[model samples]
Target: MPSRTRTHNHQLSDPFAAVLQPPPDETPAALQARVEQEQEQKRVSDQIDDELRKERTERKKRSRREVKVLLLGQSESGKSTVLKNFRLKYAPMQWKAELRSWRAVIQLNLIQNVLTLLDLMQDRLAQPDGPRPGSSGGPSSYSPPSYGRTSMDSTISEITLASSRSTLNVVLTQKHRLLNMRLSPLREVETDLRRRLGAVDPEFTFANGEDGAMNGVPGERRKSAREFGVRGWIGALGFPTSGAARNSDEPMPVDKATEILATLRDEIISLWEDSEIRELLRAKCLRIEDRPGFFLSDTARIANRTYVPSDNDVVRARLRTLGVQEWRITLEHNESFGSEWVIYDVGGSRSMRHAWLPYFDAVNAIIFLAPISCFDERLAEDPSVNRLEDTLLLWKAIVSSKVLGKTTLIVFLNKCDLLKRKLQSGIQVNKHMLSFGTRENEVGVVVKYLKDKFKDILRSDASQPRTTYLYATSVTDTKATAATLNIVRDGIIREHLKHAEFV
Candidate 1:
């Protein structure tokens, strides 16, 4: 047994002994030098370990200090707009850096508007009894059908309106055809821009079930097959990361798109400004101006080679958020509450709501945007679902969530400007929501009614006792939104401090 133990020990130690063995003819000075070298290596290793420990400590501290906020709302409820407003206020430098990149998005918006108009014109021209040269007021003025009490009734009304419009006809002139032919090249530019922006499907068609269906004739399917979206905002602009690309003389995809827009500027302006085209759009109830990312009004400036997007323009720019986007902003001005903030801008479509559950954990606050203007509208993904109803359901689900029991809830009854416009245009709220109950259709009353509804949900549905802050916001108006955001920022920071036990 002793011999077996000795053999096993020898086998294990032989490799270590051989590795530790120095040169056969080693001098004292050489041995000293080897020891010094090993000492230096050990010092470096120890230093690295010390650094790793410090880094871990700092990360833990930051996790406690970081203000994590999640922007929540349905699609087109102004979540992204609110995020842009935050960046505009807190991260001005980063926002300015991304401004030039938005030129492509603005140009794409213009092209899409033009293309949709052209398609509508083509569809109108195809009708058998198209609009005569001077036809005026012959059962031609279009009025949207009234919204019924239930969502099913609303859907039926929409379907009825769509079916009724299919029988009406309109016409276009030779000038319109020539303009369409000239603008055809923009289709290729649109394709190139989509490629650069990382659009999931280049040939994707935006169905008319949402707001502003092409020609407002949903059944006829005169929709434009142009939608530009990116998987992420980072590097989507195709801008240079390092100084290497700046030194090169090559033009980027955005540059080419800019050139095309400049070349076709006159045609685009003419098409947009045509009186007959305006009349046709009015007749079809297609208010292209009210649509998100509408830039045709500024075609002259936007299409110029020297065009640069202003702060308002960038805020108003529409880029669909495909997934949750993390934006870190270090508050330069306010250091008392916290320095670093992480804002998660999540996709708000019904299909994307499933991805939102995991993010609910550890979120410091949730800024829920409900577009009250969409009360009379149906969800694009599920036509049967009313948008306002969807928002209410989502709000109930969020407030009742045990995972978010301790989270701070902030509700922005967003898009109030659009809501006012919609109300002013004779859209009654009670027709769509019976619970609105013959209240005044003024902006203040509507906002209060909606606010009360949200408050009621919070009072009844929250899993734990919590406080909710509510605001009436038109996020597109940066100036007003900036003021509102200041209050929001301070409130969130206060809650964060309380959670960290610093208050």
Candidate 2:
């Protein structure tokens, strides 16, 4: 019987097999070369396999070590800002790319402000015949000279209306220029931008309405985020209500949107800063201060040709979290903690709270943010309910959750900066918050009072009480937040390691 020969087959593809197989009737030198080539290829393949196996081993170890953190708060409670800060710290390149998309959102915010201001101005101008709504209607104490009084007053009022109309007319033209020049359906603009960058997933829309509470929380009503501003803005602008074909013109370059705002920057700022316009707004009870991106005052800077939003600007830019967004970032600073960390930023509105229960059981820790500055503010969705009251209720629900009872809880009494400013401005907290009666309206005093209130709730409501840590955080301050994040990271790592040891 012929001697049998054994040949090892590595699963090489057809192209590789042809090159690897030795020719028949090969000479010794040729056979030696083929053997060496085969050995070399095998060595490379084995090295790759070794590396992959090591990676798998490491992945398994990391899966056991992974930490999941949830950011919980009411809408605009600064949860997303906290998430952005994390991205800024650990994934700057990605954050910088994200800023490009934010540019459009910023522009929309600016447009929204201008549109609102103009509408109020027009309403006031239209009503020159009587005292502005909400204004004191008592007759003037000093009567003007009777001579030609009626004719002169009528002439002056007509001229004032004519002037405002002229300004409104100009504003109307610019508004159309911006809206019609391919600015609608901001989603497509963002999507096109991502496509240009070779991104497969659609970009996240950061506008602050829809899929959230109508007022800014979940309980009001669910509206499309698109319907919040862009879709409805056309009718609001007093333009033809007819379904004007969506600005199908080529996507406006980010820089082009900036340029459009720049060209109209003077008009926008003038209207914003006009003392007369300000008076009218106050009379109309249109308080822009409570709204997001009140940029009329910052027009010059926002409209600058080379303007790139700073970290603070991006934080101040309002976008309501519509649903749960997850980010997986490799931990670089606290290497002892784990290989990766996953963070979930859920929409803080009431309706969105339903989504939080699923995450509670899985999250290793919770960063609960409450805007202490919001004590005097009212919930946008429900005006009768105080914002601070809503925050307190939300905090109670989170800390008391049965599923999350064991999760590490870190409370961030956020917006301390705004709180300090509000106190210093001589705004009486007791006047707005009756419960705050008889207490000193000082920053330190108010902060401690608020902190104690939160702690009392936690102490009373937690299913299984543990030490709940609190921080007076102003997330806009990167250095301060970074330091706080480190403390949080270290605390989490220690707990994780201790838990693993016990397990």
Candidate 3:
């Protein structure tokens, strides 16, 4: 419920350079010989383990094959969008919510996805990592029975087993700084826009963009994130609520918020009851409630469309993709020759990610965002930077956390189409460093370039050298393919397999 306080000025060169960890020690030759000798007697036991795994995979092939996936990133990163799109084949537009809350749910899913990714990494890495975070290697053969750092129910959990087939545990830990890069909704926009409709409204004051956000006053007070969502309607909306109020007690005026949603829903549903209204809603494709107030008319209508619906309860519908099924799991071992994984996921705001690491003592892999196309842009020009800093802060938190290399690390270079375009167009973006007057499109560069320039950010005590892979993607569609993600996911799993061999 707290807004992140990390500022760009706080992000500096990694000062911790002397702490790289040594690789895991190999079994001494004599110890290895002894183990091999012991293995002669236990050959049947090892064979049984192999046979069980092969059997499980074969059995799972005929089933739903549940794989736990965790998604992690800063606030507003495309983690949720990517996940929503990933399962598009199963159910499109399932996780609906008011837009702002949609972002919140996305954040939660991100955390869940992180946990799920860890489950996959751990299950795949199950072969060699030493005792998992919470397992003791029993026939229960299940992941550690604990929830993540911020399980949705963070309360007493009921343990239920899947009908026993094949499943993977994953964890998603997303630390979103700013929940949404938007302004207040339902303000007197008609009054303000009336002064200047077609033109970039003149009342929108932005003499400069400092402290990373593009909303600024060159020499005076800067505008808050609330203003940018609607190009500065603050006077009409009064001062936007503080971070605390906005996050918890009140997010926008509840009365106005509900009214807006109900109005849209009524308008859209009326169309279904009558053909004319449906046509009108389709041509307009709604974009209101600042940023997160997305929704729809009926559950049936929600299931019927892929684009933003034009009608009631548009907030949540816009936020969630239909039937979002993201997940993450971490299993810590209680015995030897086995290990555990802790997963994290999307729960908008870096604050959510900040709550995920302790459970990660069992983490086996991390899914990080490396929007390569972002490397060619500057944060200042990025229209959605209100929440970008939180992501970096979250990354900083990860690189500096205690879960160094109990697992493998995978960095997805998302938004690949954008990156590919920039590279083809000969544009070079730098995320680690930024200059004045940089444009929005350039912010991608900074996001992509953060690591190459910030050494301390990725330093860990583990000897594996925390791995990263670039996954280029475009959720709204610009020639992005699931294959790109497959390449990234497969690469991470393959390397994870090699790493697990030592466990």
Tell me the number of clashing residue pairs for each predicted model.
0, 5, 130
lDDT of 2 by residue, 421-443 (tens): 77886666765554566899998
Q: Indicate whether candidate 1 or candidate 3 has the larger TM-score.
A: 1
Can you rank all candidates by TM-score, best first?
Answer: 1, 2, 3
* Residue 485 of model 3, lDDT score: 50
108-219 per-residue lDDT for model 3 (tens digits): 2222222222222233334454323344442123321221221221211222111111221211112110111111121332223322322122123344533222222110
Q: 1 or 3, which is superior by lDDT?
A: 1
| Candidate 3 positional error at 57, Å | 15
Candidate 2 — what's its lDDT?
A: 0.61
User: Residue 118 deviation, candidate 1, in Å?
Assistant: 0.9
Which clashing pairs does model 2 show? 213-217, 215-380, 215-381, 218-350, 218-351
TM-score: model 2 vs. ground truth? 0.67
Candidate 3: residue 426 Cα off by (Å): 15
Please report how far candidate 3 places residue 238 from its true position, in Å. 34
Residue 405's lDDT in candidate 2: 72
